[model samples]
Target: MSLVRRIMHQGFMPLFWLALLLSAALGLHQLETLFQWIQPDTRAVIYSRDSFLSLLLNHLSIVGIAALVSIVIGVGAAIAVSRPWGRDFLPLVSQVASIGQTFPPVAVLALSVPLFGFGAVPTMFALILYGLLPIVRNTLVGLRGIDSSVLEAARGVGMSSVQVLLQVELPLAMNVILAGIRTSVTINIATAAIGSTIGASTLGDPVISGLVNGNTAYVLQGAILIGLLAVTVDSLFERLQNSFSVMEDRLIK
Candidate 1:
């Protein structure tokens, strides 16, 4: 066990080191372009620093809001449909989530534009729709997967339904819930790039610009950065899930 722990620690150390190195490299590259943008005399390949920052902030905000909204609605929907009163509604909700996933983001934007107008509203709506399935489905799966014995025991102890859910089911199912949130967030990060198509500024701005101007370098830069960000966030969530799993294991033991 000590040897296994040592090996795992060694593996993690190098992995973290490499991630830090790559992050620093990307940061330096971004900084160099930023410095060039601010220098009036320097004509950089990228646009002005202010423009880049604005685009980045706009994209992040829209994506962040969309992901947040999706989490709340998706988790709520999951919990609702899990209960006996709402069980019959599960299929309908699942169908809706499926439809949302099947619908093209571009199509959602097109339809939403008429109702919500241009800018972030349409984009955010589309993102939330696109990002709901994993979270909702996972929540259902997690809740259902809980051991029946534990639940019965809780009920036998005179626990109310709410108490059983809060103290037993939810705690046991939290890792799965976190996993769903992680998946949703990562998917949103990628889908958020599509928001740029509807004039919602985001990291996708550079990639779109690159596509228009045939700037492979800029497209690569944007794509790589977005991929890296998604991977990092997903990894963080996986770690969190594992931590919860460990705690649950210890409790069970």
Candidate 2:
């Protein structure tokens, strides 16, 4: 039990990412051999050559950029709203985030396509918007929940406002902030699969192609890869949560 806990605290994100890459690059392409026997009637309509790897890479790249953007904006906004000078804007912030999420990713893409043209730009715009709400909400919740006395004590110690926030509050709130990030990233992973409709080249390529060509194999392949990717990243986030718990305990002690 202790050993398992230790490993969780060490973080499994790197391993999960590596395995996801290897499986998508090698395992995904070879899957047709096994799937062929199950659905002999349907022809494989997968990417030509090892283009599956390129598709997977492109998929990861776009999602990665979107998630990165979402985190920056979400976390920054949450921090600003949590502060004294920014408290009045909390409602405005909440409303904007709610509206961002309420607007469908497909609509965001469709509307953006006219301005940005078909490809990664529109898809990324959609993804960043789609991913923002959870991050901002979670961060705001975490910061709000921090013990007032903790901040008071930090301030009492002659620490400047910035020092208290960076050295004390941020660390204490990190786990909660990360939980919001996990939710943000997890939701975006599956949402990003649909980015292919706008030509962003993701695991959704097979799903879109399969639908167009009426080949279940293509759909299954895409779904399997995308599902695995989501699950793997979720596990990584779980590990990160565990790791932060351990770190938090150590800091408290």
Candidate 3:
């Protein structure tokens, strides 16, 4: 298949999800009667405190920031510990990342609130902490998975350490690293919704409000959007991973 055609084919599903997500967010009020049925006793079936689009954007921003930070720190740490000179610290770094992952996101959020004081910052802080494990672990797996013979060959070819890492090691390990990123981001998307409980403006707001007010309609609305968003992102990552695999195959050939 032509590159353009292949690209389009791979992109189709994500585009479809994006369209559905937009339609649901924008046309939510049109389903008022349906929501009313879900929460028959509530005066307001629609979530009117904020638009779904705004909440979605806020949620994405929070996750995006956290994911970016996590990627940088996680990837960097893994790379550092993978180096010959840094090998002694590998166990320590892994332990730290594992501990961070073991910490409950809700507990992190609650703890950060006192320091960051109730906003997107604390939520992001919690997300970054919770999201690091997958990324760090995957990066380590990717880097360590490289064959020693490959590195020896690279060095024999007169490639500098940096050159081998940048040109060969990274290229080979990219897919695994990306898989980690996908896992981290997907988890963050779901966890970020919980930020609403701590005063962060997120899709979780409706769900929290719904629970507080005993309105199932509000809860359903938030859930639908969050689920759609997660699927969309996951689809996007899958497409990216496929593209990377194709490129790597081409390079190998």
Candidate with top lDDT is 3
TM-scores of the candidates are: 0.79, 0.87, 0.93
What TM-score does prediction 2 earn?
Answer: 0.87
| Residue 90 alpha-carbon offset, candidate 2, angstroms | 1.4
- Model 3 CA deviation exceeding 4 Å by range: 1-7
lDDT of each: 0.72, 0.79, 0.90
The residue pairs that clash in candidate 2, if any, are none
Answer with 1 or 2, whichever has the higher lDDT.
2
Give one digit per residue, the lDDT tens place, for model 3 in 28-140.
88999999887888799999999999999999999999999999998988999999899999999888877777777778778989899888888999899888889999999
How many residue pairs collide in each prediction? 1, 0, 0
Backbone-clash count (model 2): 0
Ranked candidates, highest TM-score first: 3, 2, 1
Model 1 lDDT tens row, 1-253: 7434544454464456448535633463566555445443634545333354455566668777888888889888988998999999998887776665677656766787788887778888877877788788778888989889988999999999999888888888888888878777877777677777777777787678768866655565567656655665665565566667777898788
Worst 10 residues of 1 by lDDT: 42-51
101: Cα error in model 3, Å = 2.8
